[model samples]
Target: MEQISSFFHSIGTFIHSKHQQGVYNTVCLAILLGLPVLIFLFSFFICCHCCCCSRQRKDSSSSGPAHGKKRKKKEEDLWISAQPKLLLLEKRASLLV
Candidate 1:
């Protein structure tokens, strides 16, 4: 039992010594604390970038049709006038049937 206790004590002393003077503590602290902070900052910047891009798209689309695309009002008006005639023809054909 004494041998086992001495072995454990020596192991503990070695760990303590390493902890006090080695780079192990610094690396452990960075992994435990710095990693989470770095991840949070990265995610925040990515979210902001995505939101800005989407907002730009929404603003541009809301501004109306792109340049060089003109509205064809004359063709639209002709189609509008033809609708009633087409409806009349459909009704007459249904009556004959």
Candidate 2:
């Protein structure tokens, strides 16, 4: 804490010196405005990076070395798509037939 205070105090003394008034104001204004802009951009970048990484991780993990990708047979694909309409016994029998 004391070190931080001394650092700022040194900066204050430097800025308050006769030749540096504009330097002081400019530095202060830049920090005041630019700090928030920097924070917003950093947060936005982190959020986007995290979301993209998560999606990639999920996709890769699902298709990783252990669980290989299995292609469904055409017959299986047909049954899967027609599953919603298979409620009727007659329709189910017709399909089997």
Candidate 3:
């Protein structure tokens, strides 16, 4: 147990070598400590971006023809007029027969 603890102490001492110790090194250590937080934030943003794209696709599908009320009205009118024209053609065909 003493050997194991001393091994860890030596490793710590090696890592904290005076030549490599400074404010910049401290900041680097702090940044390394926060690396997991940075990775989580990156993944969170990627998930949000994916969700946004899926929502956009759903909105586009739901809003497709309904978005242009004027165009829908025009199509309805064309169909209404076509029915009368079709009836007239049928009547002319009956008279010829």
Candidate 4:
């Protein structure tokens, strides 16, 4: 029983001594202290970048076609103006079937 208790005590002492002045402890401490700072920096940059992009987009949108004429042409292209032809084609295809 005495030998077992001494063995456990020596193990505990060795673990404590090694941990107090060890590379493992130093690495763990560095990560624990640096991780939050790193995350904060990354998030700060991301938020700033997103806000800048949104602001630029909003400013461009508020400029009211001042940016270019391509958008207007694209919008015009999206409108369908041949409804009568489309209707005739549908009727003919249905009649043929």
Model 3, TM vs. native: 0.41
> Which portions of model 3 show Cα errors greater than 4 Å?
1-21, 66-97
lDDT of 1 at 49: 100
Over the stretch 1-97, how does candidate 4's per-residue lDDT look in tens digits?
Answer: 9999999999777667757898897677668769999999999999999999999999989977664545654465656689888888888744464
lDDT of 3: 0.78
Clashes of 4: 0
Error of 2 at 8 (Å): 31
Error of 1 at 96 (Å): 57
lDDT of 3 at 82: 69
Error of 2 at 46 (Å): 0.8
Candidate 1: residue 87 lDDT (0-100): 82
Candidate 2 Cα errors over 4 Å, as ranges? 1-21, 67-97
Candidate 1 residue 72 C-alpha distance from true site, Å:
21
lDDT of 1 by residue, 1-97 (tens): 9999999999777667767886977578558768899999999999999999999989998898777667886655335567788888888845564
Residue pairs of candidate 2 with colliding backbone atoms = none
Each candidate: RMSD? 15.8, 15.5, 16.3, 12.5
* Per-residue lDDT of 49 in model 3: 100
Please provide, for model 3 over 3-47, each residue's C-alpha lDDT reduced to its tens digit, 9 standing for 90 to 100. Answer: 999999996786587337777776777687689999999999999
